[model samples]
Target: MTCKSSTTPVMGIHLHDIHSMASKLETLTKNQQLDQNDIKSILIVIDLNPEPMSIDDELESSKLTRKEFAKSIKKLAELKLIDWDFNW
Candidate 1:
């Protein structure tokens, strides 16, 4: 992901520079409604499964049931945070 500064057209924010600070931003942006555990769970699945991970796979990896993982992914999709495509 590329982060462009609003004030500077020529500058881009490097991921390494803001990587540490994004966690707090993520929490606040998620409306502070989701706890750290929830965010951690989601991140774990995303980080581990770079490919198009099936809902079942994510659930199994995160120790969450299929239903729970589905709900979380649905919310993430609604937030425009992830793009999912189904071929089958």
Candidate 2:
């Protein structure tokens, strides 16, 4: 029941940040695709869970049911799903 890692954040991102944004980003999307230039897009970044988590973890944290969360979203407009398989 513990977060896998706190000190060693994955890709310079922390789980706590995700936990904090959980409520804000819930009912939205996971594994959001973004970069420095696109950071200003609150609609996507904030709406979509900007945190990266494993398929299992994302489903668990999502407000949507486990079966409801869709993995590997092909595209969001011009954006594509960016997922990292680090076993997070």
| Positional deviation of residue 19's Cα in model 1 after best superposition, in angstroms | 20
Error of 1 at 11 (Å): 22
**Tens digit per residue, CA lDDT, model 1, 1-88:** 1122222243222222223234444566667665655444333112223348643564455576544444544544544444444222
Q: What's model 1's lDDT at 74?
A: 51
TM-score of 1: 0.34
Candidate 1 weakest ten by summed lDDT:
1-10
Q: Model 2 — which ten-residue stretch has the worst lDDT?
A: 69-78
Which residue pairs clash within candidate 2?
A: none
State the lDDT of candidate 2 residue by residue for 1-88, as single tens digits: 1222212323332333343333333334454634534322222221234346554565555554432322212122213313322222
What C-alpha lDDT do the candidate models reach, one value each? 0.40, 0.33
lDDT of 2: 0.33
Off by over 4 Å in 2: 1-11, 27-82, 86-88
RMSD of each: 10.8, 10.7
Name the top lDDT candidate: 1
